[model samples]
Target: MVQVKVFDCEHEKDLEESMNKFLQKIDEKNILDIKYNVAAMVELDEDEQIYCFSAMILYRK
Candidate 1:
């Protein structure tokens, strides 16, 4: 059967670490693919921008 795991973090390094830890418990051969994405947005009243880091892992368990 195919399954997916999703990870999200405020920082890229955090996401990378989280993914690595999860991957360590699973069989590498079962991994089908990984998708990563980032997005940034600023509020109209704020000078700072907010960012989002996310990833998806498709695999078979």
Candidate 2:
């Protein structure tokens, strides 16, 4: 069956580490595709910016 796993993190390194750990437990042949994305936005009243790192894994087991 096909399934999707989603992950989100504040930093790119954190996202990469999390994805790597998950991938290690699964078969590489079962992976269909991986989608990654990043977005940045400023706080409502702050000068600092917030970053969002996210990814989606599509696979069949």
Candidate 3:
């Protein structure tokens, strides 16, 4: 059986940082395949002062 997991994060340092952290959590070092898409988006201000983008990752282990 293949195992799948979802990881999420907000832009604090950088999106790459979030991805790295998420990758570290996965026990399987070798990923068979993976895909990612925008999971959530938020505008903190009326003028779009701040924008937040979250992503969803699908991978097989």
Name the candidate that leads on TM-score: 2
Q: Cα lDDT for residue 13, model 3?
A: 55
TM-score pick, better of 2 and 3: 2
Candidate 3 on 1-61: residue-level lDDT in tens? Answer: 4655554445645666876787897756455556554444446565454434444555555
Error of 2 at 53 (Å): 0.4
Across 1-61, the per-residue lDDT of candidate 2 in tens digits comes to 9999999999999999999999998899999999999999999887899999999999997
The deviation in Å at residue 8 for candidate 2 is: 0.4
Candidates ranked, most accurate by TM-score first: 2, 1, 3
Q: lDDT per residue, candidate 1, 1-61, as tens digits?
A: 9999999898999999999999998898999999999999887797888899999999999
Candidate 2 positional error at 5, Å: 0.6
For candidate 2, the lDDT comes to 0.96
- Lowest summed lDDT across 10 adjacent residues in model 2 is found at 39-48
Give candidate 3's error at residue 12 in angstroms. Answer: 8.2
Candidate 1 — worst ten consecutive residues by lDDT sum? Answer: 41-50
List pairs with backbone clashes in candidate 1: none
Runs of candidate 3 exceeding 4 Å displacement: 12-15, 22-29, 39-45, 49-61
Best by lDDT: 2
User: lDDT for each of the candidates?
Assistant: 0.95, 0.96, 0.57
